[model samples]
Target: MASILITGGAGFIGTNFVRHWRRAHPNDEILVLDALTYAGNAANLDGLDQVRLVVGDIGDTELVRQILRNHDISTVVHFAAESHVDRSISGPAAFIETNVVGTHSLLMAAKAEWLDRGSGRPHRFHHVSTDEVYGSLGPDDPAFSETTTYSPNSPYSASKAGSDHLVRAYHHTYGLDTTISNCSNNYGPYQYPEKLIPLFLLNCLRGIALPIYGDGMNVRDWLHVDDHCQGIEKVIANGRSGEVYNIGGGQELTNIAVIDAICTALDRAFVDTPSLAQRFPAAPAANGQPSASLKSYVTDRQGHDRRYAINASKISNELGYAPRRDFAAGFAETLAWYLENGDWWSALLDKAQR
Candidate 1:
């Protein structure tokens, strides 16, 4: 049984990963370190009993070092990142502070803790990153392979790129058994409402306009949260040190397509249900309008990438990682989760808006 330390274990993807790992490895002792920032909700871990949650920042070097030493953590899963691109646009400083500096501090703390524990005990530091570090992909360009050069276009991605570099440096310089996995867009239950899927879902439910940036053709590879968690577990268990893996479900879909799919799902879900039908009526006809009626075009975001796709062949071939949930099934489950668990996201939205 391994003793693991996970940073940002209260955030969206991080929380999901912690829950997944606890269930998968029942004997493992899991310690979650979170800053309890605006985005990090302790409520995400309300019913989870196996995880030992500590409210702290990854940037807190002394705190992190203490946690590492006290927990006897053999693995460090770094998932604490300021990841929202729009938020990064509005405020880039937080991104740099939390993503770059915070990661560096955590790595140093973990390195010191590892040394104190004696080099004989096996230790691994796994960094979870996003595919946006590769920049935009053209229509015909190949998917982002593990070898793709880092061309971060947004502040968020740039900060993450910096963190990724730090992780690599630690592995090469200190031989701190480490691995990095870059993943595509993830959508599933417990996701904060700031992202596309939950944002659109909540907007649709609230009778608010669904904002589509530009022509709404920006493409993204959607991976289920469970699949991403599985990929991380695979890397932690079997990944090579100083290596990078790309994890993706390969569910390539355009932005407009995603909005349409969600609406269609809601429409179907509403049908044959009086309460839901009362909540959301059928959309009006086009009325000779050239643009789609369901989505309203909004100002394009700063430094928005037109496309992001990952070549997940490396992980699939090397670690036998395969995404079990297709978009349809996965999306259905995600939508149902939001519909069923309104209180969780409602409280999150309230806090974010505040």
Candidate 2:
């Protein structure tokens, strides 16, 4: 019967975690704080039990303090951030504001309420972060371990690095109970259409050109959202305070290979489910052509990391963490979700256009 606070609960990963937490701990009371930004959709958390959504910013320290004190929140899962790399490149200021300053503010509220104000109550603050903070990995380089040095390459990663540092400082400086997880790329349902998997899936449906940056050979470790959520759950439940964990799916695939996989999946779907061909008539599969025909090469991004992989041995050995969803089945389920829930994403896209 713990009271928990989840920031950015309306966003992709946060939403999944909130639902996951509810199912695992049905008696816990949950409060969600979100800014209702373009990346966040309140409707995502609609109809969930024992959950309250409060539209607000994490940067509002006093507001956060009140939420903490009034609700008697014993745990906070911080997931609010401006996380898109391309968006960060074009506008670094927002990244710094939300990721760095906003995180600092949230920590201040927690310290004031849980530490300074003293209530003998147990508390935890878990920070969710990315593996990009370790910079790029060469072809033969070892996967990023928890001991990897900080070498953030992009504005988004740099900002996350800053937040991670602040969380560490709070733990050491004020003895605030805290833990952090640096995870690899996540893809699943309810993800905004800006990321690679969802964006390409939507484009394939509309017959739009699939843009491939550089030669498309850059590699990434793909972690299913469900697996990532489970890892976070393990950390929150059994993690040692002031420690860091790396969560990964152990599935590595090149960008071009992922695109080809998506194309192949769509081709099979169109053939077996004839109605898909009627729904997306423009898709090359509808007319007996390969979806790969729509590939469009483009300029590479600035400071793009060559590769990113995570070493999850620490979490596995310490917390018994292991990814459950294989890429093949996970990807097929993700694609099926997008196809079946057209109304959900369509409304978001329509709003964005307007």
Candidate 3:
């Protein structure tokens, strides 16, 4: 069985992938390395069997080297990074240090262990990235393909783009077996509340105003975390070396559309429980309405991309990777998960406040 090192395994997509990988390959050993930043929650990975967690910075070369050599890790799924765009705009240094420097450190360590120290066995280093690296698109522009020119708009996307280049450099310069997947926006369980979906969901539950930035016309391709993980698995298993794949859910929706969807789901959820409205008395109202009426317009984020859509045909045709989750159905299920697991997300918010 192969030992796989999943960096940032405690974060949203990383945690989902760990759970997915555990079920799909029960015998394969998994090692998680996370620094447990504000976005990382250990509880997201709780109750899983046979997976080891190592809390540490990915930039620590010695620590990364030890883990690679000691664990006999043959696969590295690099996910650790400061990924929030707003945060990156307010403070780009953390993004550079973690996304760029940390990725470089991990790449060097992996190269040392897999290529220099041991016999050159076939190993994999899969870099998980975002479609924002391709920059914004106009209304009539085609979806971003693997060949899309890199024009990262925000600092977070720029940092990720830098890391993507590093991975490519390692593959070409040193023959390190590597692959990359640039996915669209991911929304599902265990996602940090700062993101749009979960953030609006929590606001709807707590009876607070769902703040929509600017006119809320910015568009994003939403991919469920589970579907994204499946694509990652397919890429790792069958993807050609030194290749890049685009993974998308094929569901494009504006930010306002996403919020409206969540509001509708919340209305259904609270249909029978009128008393729930009593709990969140402070929920703002618009034009004398209630709940979803609480949607308030806010200033737009700086450097916000106008639109991001992914053309996943490369992965679909080459590796037979297709997203299995339908947006409406999967989104409802995701809302249900948050509704049932209130304590899980509540505890995370509590910790963040502390």
Top lDDT model: 2
Error of 1 at 272 (Å): 3.5
Sequence-dependent TM-score of model 1:
0.95
Report the lDDT tens digits of candidate 1 across residue range 1-354: 778899999998999998998899988888999998887888888777668989887889999998878777889999999989998998999999999999999999988888645656788999999999999999999999999999999999999999999999998998888999999999998888889999887777666678999999999999999999999999999998889999999999999999999877766665544465444443321122211345788899877899999999999999999999999999999988987887787787777677
Candidate 3, which ten residues in sequence have the lowest lDDT sum? Answer: 280-289
lDDT tens string, model 3, 74-169?
899998989999999999999999999999999999999999986677799999999999999999999999999999999999999999999999
lDDT by residue for model 2 (256-276), tens = 989999999988989889999
Model 1: which ten-residue window has the lowest total lDDT?
283-292
- Report lDDT per candidate: 0.87, 0.95, 0.91
Worst 10 residues of 2 by lDDT: 198-207
Ranking by lDDT: 2, 3, 1
Off by over 4 Å in 1: 116-119, 277-294
RMSD of 1: 2.8
lDDT value, residue 232 of candidate 1: 97
What is the TM-score of candidate 3?
0.96
Residue clash pairs of candidate 2: none
TM-score on alpha carbons, each prediction: 0.95, 0.99, 0.96
